[model samples]
Target chain A: MAENYQHIQTAHCENGVVTGLLKHQGLDFMTEPLAFGLGSGLFYIHIPFLKVSGGPAISFRTVPGAIFKRTCKALQIEVVRKKFSNELLAQQFLDEKIAQGIPVGCQVGVFHLSYFPKEYRFHFNAHNIIVYGKENDTYNISDPVMETVTTLTIEELKRVRFAQGVLAPKGHLYYPKSIENFDKKLIQRGIVKGIKRTVNDMLHIPAPIVGISGIRFTANKVKKLRAKLGIKQGGLFLGQIVRMQEEIGTGGGGFRFLYAAFLEEAAEYLQDDRLIPISEQITKAGDLWRSSAVQMAGIYKGRITEQKDFDDAANMLYEIAEVEKTAFKQLEKLKFNS
Target chain B: MEKKDIPQDTSPLKNMTREVYYVKNSDGKYETGLSAGWVVKNEALENAWEDINEQVRAAKQAVLTGEKSPIYYYFVLQLMDYNVLSGYTGFWKFSIKKHMTSKGFKKLSDQKIEIYAKVFNITVDELKNFNH
Candidate 1:
């Protein structure tokens, strides 16, 4: 039997999957921004030693499953998550869950998902989607990134669930078993706590490769890419940053814009007008980040190699760091209505 | 990129769903948008694909010359770097690297081969005779 599952496309995967799953549980429908904000999805990290697709790692969001897990914890929602070592067992469990009328959110590799664009397929295994029903050999998919619902064969589904690489899905599955109407007061508290945690992460993390420091740290390395990695490798490395920011997880602007959207919605919900301007500040900062990626894309395409352009892009990051520092500090000091 | 500046990749190979990107507009807001295959974003992706393709091509060339083992080709096909493959297979990076060479690959014990085949999601026979 095909269970009724709503397919709502959103900019990011995990948050969208969470939103869809939560709504399917008869809980008040949640927006993607709210899910992201409650989950504290905003983050930044640039690991110089860790290579992703032949270039250093540059990530804009919290690690995979962090948002969904944290948001569920904060809301005190009854949810269950599991990781399977045996592919057959995982499929069996999924079938059992669907037979029980539960729509399960699954972590999958994007490379083998037949619905994805051919060019977009990579070894990224952290993509999240919903498996609501199974009809013979086909599983009904509610992939949050796709514009519409799709179906996958049992073999194709198994391949993606068992895909190997960093952050492999490991046939991970999660779903809410029980949900009640969320209290507005509790939601407000969750939002405020999420904001405080994000602010601290952006400003307080002592690691040089995380938070605002990481931005500047990456900028410094980017400036020396030509000298350190040589011309061709440096160009490719720079291109990897563009791919990470724009193509991978980001809807655009390295997820700063999405965070900005969350903040804007937060402002309205919290009834704190101050958050509106802070949201705009973050949006402006997101613009600058996008500009840097745009300039780096130019560098990758061999259009601009001038040190000045690289310098300008690095300088733009420095400026964004400053803007974020100020905005987050403002957010930290913000008072929510009790 | 300007709407007009986006590349018009009319090639039959272009995949519409993959080519589309979420981009920021002039007003500093992001919207799901399409890119002409020639944009810098697409170029970056193309560069990644090229690197992945090169690994596969090099593995095939090495197999043809009998310079490396079929394991090397499968490793690349699995989208794994040496470090990742080593970590999953419980072998040192150097050991994995050594196994890639024709001589070392031929000397593999069944236990080691079983571990590798399991990691790669292939049968032992498939790992041994991976001409395809």
Candidate 2:
């Protein structure tokens, strides 16, 4: 079952799973950037009331399963997704799929994933992986974040699959059921739809805690963090942002650079030269975010503790918010021939 | 970021797989590149671990002084907060908070203790007897 399976490394897990599964089913055009683009994976939200691992819940991308679901929906591919309430049934279902030689994607927590580095293992439960085959009691895993394929024992897999917490997997497993041959025009249409949705998401969302407004809100809060929460707690807060933006599977710059890469790919696929410049704009935003991360690191590391340093970081984010706002506005105005 | 500019600082991911990143080449085209690690991110991760360890130490001290239960120490050791512990054991957050106290843990039935032990992946005896 694993003979023909090819492991593809990607910057993020969900995008990698979607790209790999589609490529396995004979869709050669499936790339990580294209998958992320068509899935509208770029997003930002800061939920102050929620805490993830003692830090404020800050997300750099859309929700966990949205990429796979949206990418599949846009491509008109039939898929099977299941979440089990019974552990035995979940194991049985996965075993049946593996026996049938069908590679399936499973949502498991990273906290108990034995192959991950101990320091990276937290209570994060949204990690995605592909189980292509089973050899004895071990399952062949293709975690896209890693450089090569890995394995997990049956018990280890079960533990991670049933890891209980916020956004628990509950033995969730998914696979593409039917993949039909699609032409370039279908992809072009998907690109248009994806960009429209992303433009709306980043610009038209009414809530202050999401999209561009979310970036500004977080920046405003960042300016006052030292005064409001004191130095130690505020430094921790900045460190949390840095970790979420750079440490996790964001492809660096909190998915901004990845989105820019997506826009570059989409420009070529759609034969739209206008998108190239907009992609550059987003890249500029990504560069600014990196600078902001560096500034934040200095403050969090105690090398710089002045309020002006904090203001400088906040100002960088404010500029990033403007850059992204303009880029999305341009995308919203551009007409596509679909 | 440029292809050559990607940071390769020492990190916990050392000897493990490098992460994939999107970067620009000299030609200015975006491409996927492998990054060993970055110091900025490493420091953030280390800071987070430090916070966790600090909490664990405090919890251990509390348990040793009979101010809190052993379950509290185990929960902190496992990097779990009250919400996560509640989710795993199917207990209410307030109830779990109460169970963290010495008096509340002393009254726990065997079945309840078994559930906590299972969640922590430790034997009942180990859970019941935590010296350090």
Most accurate candidate by lDDT? 2
Model 2 residue A65 distance off true place after TM-score fit, in angstroms: 0.7
Residues B64-122, candidate 2: write the lDDT tens digits: 99999999999989988666798789999988988899999999999999999999999
Clashes of 1: 0
DockQ computed for model 2 against the true two-chain complex using alpha carbons: 0.75
Candidate RMSDs in order: 3.7, 1.2
DockQ each candidate and list the results.
Answer: 0.34, 0.75
Model 1 pairs in collision: none
Cα lDDT, model 2, residue A174: 97
Query: Residue A335 deviation, candidate 1, in Å?
Result: 2.1
Candidate 1 versus the native: TM-score? Answer: 0.87
Instruction: Indicate which candidate wins on DockQ.
Output: 2
- Give the fraction of true interface contacts kept by model 1: 0.33
Clashes of 2: 0
> Per-residue alpha-carbon lDDT of model 2 for A1-338, expressed as tens digits?
64588999999999999999989988998999999999999998999788666667788899999999999988888899999999999999999988888889999998899988899888889999999999999999999888899999999999999988888899999999857666557788889999998898899989999999999999998999989887778888988998989865789899989999999999898889899999999988888988998999898888999899899999999999999999999999999888
